[model samples]
Target: MDWKLENIILGVTDVDRAKEFYTQSLGFHLDVDHQASDDFRVVQVTPVGSGCSVTFGVGLNGAEPGATKGLHLVVEDIEAAYAELEGRGVVSSGIQHFDVATGGMAPGVDPEHRDFMSYVYLNDPDGNSWHVQEAHHKGAEG
Candidate 1:
C-alpha cells in the first residue's frame, strides 16, 4: 500500500485573486476551476514538478485567510530560486541560513551549502506564507 498527498485546501477570500497569485506570480499550473453555484467554487493549482496541488475557493474549508504558515517548497539551489522569484516580481525575504553552532540564523545561503539549511520566505496575496528551503543532493560517484 502507498499513501500520497494530492491536495491542500486553502481558505481564501477571493478565489480568482488566489488563482492568479499562484498561477501568474508563483508559476503554478492551473489544474481546475469549477463553479457549481454562486456560493461554491474550487480553484486548484500545482507548482511546477510538484505532485501536490493547492486548492482554494469559496465554501471549501474553515481555515482563516492568511492563517496558513510554514508551507515549504524545497529546491536544489536557494540562490537560484530566490533570483527567479524576484525576477517574477514576487516579494520575498533575503536568503538566510541556520547556524548550527549558535542555533541561530544568519544572512545569506548556508556557508557549507548544506541541504535543508538555507531558506527564504514569501507570502501569497492573502498572506499565506511559504518557506523555500535548499535541499540539494549529490549524485553517487561513478
Candidate 2:
C-alpha cells in the first residue's frame, strides 16, 4: 500500500499562538488556515523538509494546547544543529546522553559514549517537547 501521511493534529490552546510558534519559532511553513465554523478553524503547517504537516485549531480533542515532550525528529548533525538553533535564541536543554532504559540505545549504554549519535531537547512556544537527534550513520537532510 502506498500510503502517504497527510497531517498530524497538534492541540493548541490558541490558534494564533500555535500558528506563530510553528511559523516563527520552528520555521514551519503555513499551508492552510480556514474557518470550519463560527467556533472552529483548521490551520496546517509543514516543517521545511518533513513529509507530514501538523494541524491545530480551537477545541481540538485533548488537553489544552500543549506540546508532547520527547517527540523525536532526526537530523544529521546534532551538535551543529544545536548550535544553529541556539544562535536563533531557541531555548534548548542542551544535548543530553540517553541510556536505553530512558529510551535511548542499549541498556546501560549511553549514546554519547558509544557515539551512536547525539540528542537535544527543545520546546515549542507552549512547552511542547521536541527531541532533535543525529544518527552517526545518516547525514542531515536539513
Per-candidate local distance difference test: 0.87, 0.70
Give the lowest summed-lDDT range of ten residues in model 2: 105-114
Clashes of 2: 4
Which residue pairs in candidate 2 collide?
12-65, 13-65, 67-128, 76-140
TM-score of 1: 0.92
lDDT of 1 by residue, 16-113 (tens): 88888899988999999999999889899999989899999987865789888999998887888899899889999889999988898989988777
What are the models' TM-scores? Answer: 0.92, 0.73
For candidate 1, the per-residue lDDT at 30 reads 94
Which stretches of candidate 1 lie above 4 Å from their native place?
137-142
Over the stretch 4-75, how does candidate 2's per-residue lDDT look in tens digits? 986788767778887987787667899999997968788889887888888888745654556455667766
